[model samples]
Target chain A: MTNAERKRPGRPPGPSDTRDRILAVARELFARNGIDKTSIRAIAAQADVDPALVHHYFGTKTQLFAAAIHIPIDPMDVIGPLKKVPVEDIGRTLPSLLLPLWDSEAGKGFIATLRSLLAGNDPSLVRSFLQEVIAKEVGSRVDDPPGSGRLRVQFVASQLVGVVMARYILELEPFKSLPVEQIVDTIAPNLQRYLTGELPGLS
Target chain B: MTNAERKRPGRPPGPSDTRDRILAVARELFARNGIDKTSIRAIAAQADVDPALVHHYFGTKTQLFAAAIHIPIDPMDVIGPLKKVPVEDIGRTLPSLLLPLWDSEAGKGFIATLRSLLAGNDPSLVRSFLQEVIAKEVGSRVDDPPGSGRLRVQFVASQLVGVVMARYILELEPFKSLPVEQIVDTIAPNLQRYLTGELPGLS
Candidate 1:
């Protein structure tokens, strides 16, 4: 296809479905400033589009934000397959379930988001993220016991967040350079424990 | 003293320090965009001061960040006496040492900074912060032995971060209104265990 004929977003002057570009700018601005501080004007200026176009595309800032930061993976698509897997192996199944996805397209985007979140300069985005992503999903999965599940959930998050912190954010020596599989194998046991192990301090 | 009598940081017609004003603006910007993304220009514009004056007072972004974020408590001074205290009492001593610091003038700023961090706005700030203010000092005090202080250190941080996430960043219901000391006391044992306990599977 000729460059001109190739599908591309219609530029500013009037409305166009420029949600993707708007989202990109929003992510960058939000990463740079924060959700609260990054205004429509800034995003419009950065994206070289009209601000009203952003409203038309995404509706509200929160909706725009949800689109901007949304993990590409549908939670249903991810967790759906595991429903049939026995709860006992849910421990082992958990990491295995997640690894492939994280190794793929949607997961890679999520990983980048995690990396940005680790280093991004916005608080509201991060807080909302922790609740939306980690706390809700990870925190809710506990079946091990009472407090045990909670501890397990927190530990699971800690391990994962720590790993992301070390590997992605800090770029620690071996971890930074390690293959994803290697890191997974090394950390999966901890993941399983948090997922299925007897959580300590539980009655 | 009259406002005019207050020391101005920069030359007129260029930029002014506007210390208190800068601090106020800096807090909002920093909280919104994190330490790095929030720039001198932004702070200047917000404070109605010249950006050059920020350079005159703070010298560099790093220094400015330190001035803006560093809690006044010298970890060395506080941790020094902690070393001399009995091992078993370290848990109790820890909260006493750290809680007051978190509640102090500088500590409040630091906590506010942390609240922003927990919210996920500034990953670099959190990383360096954990490295500089938290990990190094905290790691030095705790060890891996029977009474080694380090295990609980991790727990303390985890617990504290969780509390900050829920209480400050997420602004979840009851947690928001809970007294700090009460909250600290409630979590102290868990912190103690995580700080000092033989975390299963790790050791």
Candidate 2:
């Protein structure tokens, strides 16, 4: 320990370090083991810590699961403004909103986690994540009627996911290497369709 | 066995039984392990037979993997009619078109594979499955302008997956139990929008 480190405070380490450690270990273990099979005690063991340490830190596995798999974006901050963005302008704004994240380090973590679920066999984890996170975070923001939000949100989610699969996961050649700006230009309008376009024949 | 049957049958369950047994074991194992990890030798050991038996029966692990996951639905049979559905009507017909099989035994295998993937952590599996199986099947049928056909196909896939995530995967309360017809009625128009719609502000 550095001479200054030993002199710091009453708790030794501040409260955040324990929580962060648990999440780091949880992500590794959950990736290795199926989510359903990953027990709290197992996560505790993986961390070389006590079960109480996990419970004290995360409370429940579901909550821990949520935290561990959290994407870097704070949905509230990004999406909240989207709801009020004159829904028409959303076509332009939505693509502009996601491009940087899709092209950045933090966004890659989100993409990796999303793509990982798409590649894994446990639909439960992906389903719940979509329901709890995607639905609540993205779907709930739009003021459309109850079910309308799902259609809008799901359509939007699919566009983003499809781009990820084609570009990152499947590594489709042109798209895989496309410059960030070009991709945004190409995909943004389609997303705009999902966000605010009208289907000619039906609605 | 009947006295005549036992005597008339080819040599008492010898090499023939081993081949069939190996195939059965291989099918189950491959379904569980995926093709990458399953080996001819593993199939032989699991079935308590010689490895050469696998070669005799299926020729290769790749062939065996294909056999294990093969479905009754002909890809053309699944996707062919959509070409006739007209892009406008494609949305309404989308769910009703496939939900029967998704509810069928044959469809269940595909669904099981899809469900397994949907449950997993990777988003790409669902994306690829949709692309490989559903999207390619449906999207190829929609002959629109460059981006529209692709976007239309992607939008269709998004709706179906969203429904599965809702009704099957997450088991969302009201949605989980809603009749298929109701779901079709509720969600199809949004799909219709993407299939044959004017870009909201573009038009």
Candidate 3:
């Protein structure tokens, strides 16, 4: 420890403490008002810190949101590569990218957080993430009929969320232990259909 | 009110009381020991009722389990029809039957029970229901290539469970509001693929 710190115990909040306060406030506001409606400045004010401090600690609002939710990596890490890929390949590529991440040690936290969130019967945070973030990013690209984009993405979300539940939360046999590649290959076609296939109700 | 009943204000347990006690006991035992091992006699014994009374009240072990889980209808209500459906059409037929039930008034109770169960983080009951009851009835029918039945059913379960999460729990827009028939049509093909379609690493 620095001599100055060693000499003075019981000091005021440090960098980590300030960062944690910002995250707690961000989670509350985001859950209450959703991502679009909740602002960094609002979160900063709630945390009793400067907006600049919030940004410096967590980068951007989305990044802050990720941190608040306990996702180990930025969503852009996955969404960025997805932008470059052909729409036809998104079904395969999306799961290919995500399955590995979800299977990693970091994924345990995400899964645990999801379970707790669902258990609490409050899904606003997750819903906001899906609607505002995922739907906007992937949904816009696959909006084949223009207005059908969000529904299509939501369908995709249904399947993906199911996979998470079955594989992680429910922990069903064989499905839980199956190779990730096998799952990616199997669901890719179905997910592709949701993304691009003709449907009964959609235009 | 019957005259005999009106004469007494809090008499000994009535027939409905006996039934409720049996159901509560059944849920605990079934959740702890699973369907194959938990017996109607055991549940009756725990409830301090006769095995005959348990049978008379709930009809069968599976029926008791259905009531215990608040499923409203006997699982046989779905499973019986499924037994008649050709394996080739199960994917479409399965969702066609389930979507309506899930969207029904009775389904609300089941969904609420599920939410509370999940929130409590004790999925043993749900897991048991899926593994022993649904998997046995459906998996056995789809067990193509010798031993692949259970796994196939589980994969299908992942998707179906995901649909429940999306529609009821997360209540994702559009996906949540989509017509029963629309969802049935959209997911049928995918579910059918899981049942009978060629999958990687399965052979």
lDDT of 2 by residue, B1-203 (tens): 34455457565866656655776787666656544566788888988877876787766555554444454455455566876787678888877777766666766566455544433434343343344445555656653555445555654564565455445544554455556676566557656765666533222
Sorting all predicted structures by lDDT, with the top scorer first, yields 3, 2, 1
Model 3, position A28, has a per-residue lDDT of 93
Lowest summed lDDT window (length 10), candidate 1 chain B: B146-155
The best-first sequence of candidates by TM-score reads 3, 2, 1
Per-prediction fnat: 0.05, 0.08, 0.77
A28 Cα displacement, candidate 2 (Å): 15
TM-score of chain A of each: 0.54, 0.59, 0.92
What is candidate 2's local distance difference test score?
A: 0.60
In model 1, the runs with Cα more than 4 Å from the true position are: A1-67, A77-108, A111-167, A170-203, B1-69, B85-105, B111-141, B145-163, B172-203
CAPRI accuracy category, model 1 = incorrect
TM-score for candidate 1, please give it: 0.46
lDDT of 3: 0.86
The candidate that wins on lDDT is 3
Give residue B71's lDDT in candidate 3 (0 to 100).
Answer: 82
Off by over 4 Å in 2: A1-17, A20-67, A88-92, A115-141, A144-203, B1-72, B115-141, B146-155, B158-167, B170-175, B186-203
List RMSD in Å for every model shown.
11.7, 10.7, 5.3
TM-score of each: 0.46, 0.53, 0.90
Worst 10 residues of 2 chain B by lDDT: B118-127
**DockQ of every predicted complex:** 0.06, 0.08, 0.58
